[model samples]
Target: MNEIKKVLITEEQLKARNAELGRQITEDFKGKDLLAICILRGSYIFFSDLTREIELPLEVAFMHAASYFDGTESSGKVNLPDQNMLSVEGKDVLLVEDIVDSGRTLAALKATLLKKGVNSLHIVTLLDKPDRRVVDIDVDYSGFVVPDEFVVGYGLDYDQRFRNLKYVGILKEEVYQ
Candidate 1:
């Protein structure tokens, strides 16, 4: 059996932090029509809790993107998910993602949305890895800034697994060994 190395953000902690993020968002968008655009597969969990915590009227849209295909390297090309059909012509849009590892995905997506005619655009990533950032991307809101270790759970993944784990953890070496 593989022993879990350590747990970073437990489920309870995640809930608390998520609520805090939602409160900040609620306060910010109190008088505006906000669009919560979640990047699929990863940010879905974060997105769901985040949107629910907000007390204001909000619309949501989802998009799937893949900058990392295998191992720990980014493909540098993003396959945008199909749920980007929400009208952002003049709406305040917040691009929500699970993690920003290399900053490539968020950077590309942000530029793409800007070109799509969003009235205002901002980014909020649940986790950030600035040490591995390849581009100078800045997230407007970040839940945590983590080291460059491969993390799983709380929406992050490993070979598309472990996403359901309630806490975020650095996979034990034996798991990879």
Candidate 2:
């Protein structure tokens, strides 16, 4: 079992940052057709909080795509289980994610959506780790820039535990190693 090593982001901090992001998004796409897509499982918490902040008429969708499975690092291959569930054609798409690391999953998803002919595409991530990116990806809106460490809580997980923690934290080294 892994204990939380340190509190990375407090609950109050998350709220403030997400609120800012929501306001910015609302202003940026004031009258545009916006379809916010949540990269599922990991992004559920962030997605819910963010969508509530945006004061605009928009639609919400979830895509269960993942590149990590019961491990500390990514598996390097993104899997989209419900690929045909939602259609994003001709919509201004905003991809909401829990974190952006390695950039493999987000890059693949962005390419897939672009091929579907989205009118515009933007990315919003609750956390970003620029040191781990393997592919070039642009994050339009980001909450925090984290160090190169395995973090958990706030929808990010390891074997799917600790997600209920209100704040973001660093996982104990013993847990993953």
Candidate 3:
């Protein structure tokens, strides 16, 4: 069993940030073909909220690339359950992710997307954890820069739990230990 240690980000904050990011993305990609690809399982909530806030005619897709297989630590191997589900050829791709931790998964995904002949590829993550980053990858838009704590909620999970929480929170240390 686990408990929320403290709230890292409130729901209101998330809503406001999403709206801001949406506006920025809308402005940047105005009059251009945009395909927002949601990195599945973890980023579905953020992608849904953020995409809805984007007042632009854009398409959406999903990709399941994960490095953490039911654990807090990254296994350093990206697992792509379905890779060829969408076509990104000659389209501006907006990769939506829940958190940018080790950067391994995103780097791999970015490379794969680029190889498929995308016009451009930009990353947008709900949370940015630079402290734990191993691969240097750029995040075009970031909602929050969090510390090196085990965070959960807002679609981020611990053992596939706590993802439905409305706000982001830190999980108790003992829970994962």
Candidate 4:
């Protein structure tokens, strides 16, 4: 992966697609009392832009859950927050994520929410990596479906290195070495 190709998704491309996603979300939850549940760390940037684009009245909540501890791999165990700031019981909950790789996190979160008596549950992800899927999860709205390669930037990362990259890129394997 040392041979770097050009940026896969430019900053302009990301902005345009994000705006489109925002418009769709705004239209879908027009009159309903929308509550956006954003996954922490990774999805914070995407959530910020998407929620702002949403014109309808809504509330925002955050949950910190992560499992990746090694290089390009997830621990496959999700840790829920001890003190959740937002209550979604009997409310329309839309879970927003930065990317869907293994999908274990979202699937687990959705199941927990359903068990807690959430009235409605929806999922929105900025990127989808179908090739790496280990658990079944449906994305109601997605901005892009990425290839099976290891990617970084636009909020995705490797040991938290490339989150600040404006454009998504296929990382050089040597970087990981």
Candidate 5:
């Protein structure tokens, strides 16, 4: 079993922040055609919590875009299967993500969504790790700016484990090493 080094963000903190983010989104997108897209696997928990908080009639969609394939480091190439089913044309899009690290996945998805004729695009992430970023990308709504560490929980995972934890925690280095 993998051990956690420390709890980085508590469950209470995440709940409070999610509520705040929802309010901000509701105000910004009042009466607008908003489409919240969840970057699958990692962002499922966060996407569900955040979308519920938004007090607006917005559409929700899911797309699978992966850069880290069961590893801590990104493979540098994003794998996006079929996104043709999503209707993004003339709609304000909010890409919901669990964390933003290397920025490659989000960057690629942003470009693809824009090409699909989205009226506007914005990103919302549960955690942001600027130190690990390899590409320039902007996160519109960020719950927390985390240090470059191997964190897992609340939809974040290591080899598809630890996503069930309610709060974010740093994984013990020995487990991964």
Candidate 6:
């Protein structure tokens, strides 16, 4: 049975931070052709809330990418089964992701998008676990810097469960073992 070990970020904190990020993005990308690409399965919740808070007019798209294969840690290899098919030529692209852990997934996705001749490519993630980063990557906006722990909730999951939780929390060690 899976159990929450600790609440890392509360729902209240998420709401406040998301609002701030929205305002910042709106200000930063104002008057630009903004195209927000949400890396799905984990980022949908954050993308939905964050995009709604952006005051500027923008377009949204979903790209299903995965590096984790039903486990707590990444498989090192990133896969984008659903390729980004939108026309990104000369458009400022913002990749919204739920977490930036190993950074492999984001790096691969960024490389792929860059080939599409985007005007600019930026990354925004709800959580960042810098200690686990195998590839160096910088995020334009980050909601929280978490420790090296297995987290689940607020769209993050373990074996595709616990995503519906309102707050972000660490999963019990026993759950993933």
**Residue range 24-133, candidate 2, lDDT tens digits:** 99999998999999998999999999999999999999999999875788999899887677799899999999999999999999988998989999999999999999
Q: CA lDDT, every prediction?
A: 0.82, 0.93, 0.94, 0.83, 0.94, 0.92
**Number of residue pairs clashing in candidate 5, backbone atoms closer than 3 angstroms, sequence gap of 3 or more or interchain:** 0
Q: Model 6, poorest ten-residue lDDT window?
A: 80-89
lDDT of 5 by residue, 13-114 (tens): 999999999999999999899999999999999999999999999998999999988668899999999578798999999999999999999999999999
RMSD of 4: 2.1
TM-score for predicted model 4 compared with the true structure: 0.92
What CA RMSD would candidate 3 show? 1.2
TM-score of 2: 0.97
For model 4, the local distance difference test gives 0.83
The 10-residue segment of model 1 with minimum total lDDT is 78-87
lDDT of 1 by residue, 17-55 (tens): 889988998887788878989998988888888788888
- Mark the regions of model 1 whose C-alpha exceeds 4 Å error after superposition: 1-3, 81-84
RMSD of each: 1.7, 1.2, 1.2, 2.1, 1.1, 1.2
TM-score: the better of candidates 2 and 4: 2
TM-score of 3: 0.97
Q: After superposition, how far is residue 28 of candidate 6 from its true place, in Å?
A: 0.3
| Lowest lDDT 10-residue stretch of candidate 4 | 1-10
Identify the runs in model 4 with alpha carbons over 4 angstroms from their true place. Answer: 1-5, 82-85
Regions of candidate 5 where Cα sits further than 4 Å from its true position: none
Best of the two (3, 4) by TM-score:
3
TM-score of each: 0.92, 0.97, 0.97, 0.92, 0.97, 0.97
Residue range 63-127, candidate 4, lDDT tens digits: 88776767777788887773345577888889999889999888888888887777789999988
Per-residue lDDT of candidate 3, residues 49-131 (tens digit): 99999999999999998998866899999988777877999999999999999999999998888889999999999999999
Report the lDDT tens digits of candidate 6 across residue range 1-177.
249889999999999999999999999998999999998899989999999999988988889999998677789889987775678889999999999999999999988999989999999999999989899888999999999999889898888888999999998898779
Badly placed stretches (over 4 Å) of model 3 are none
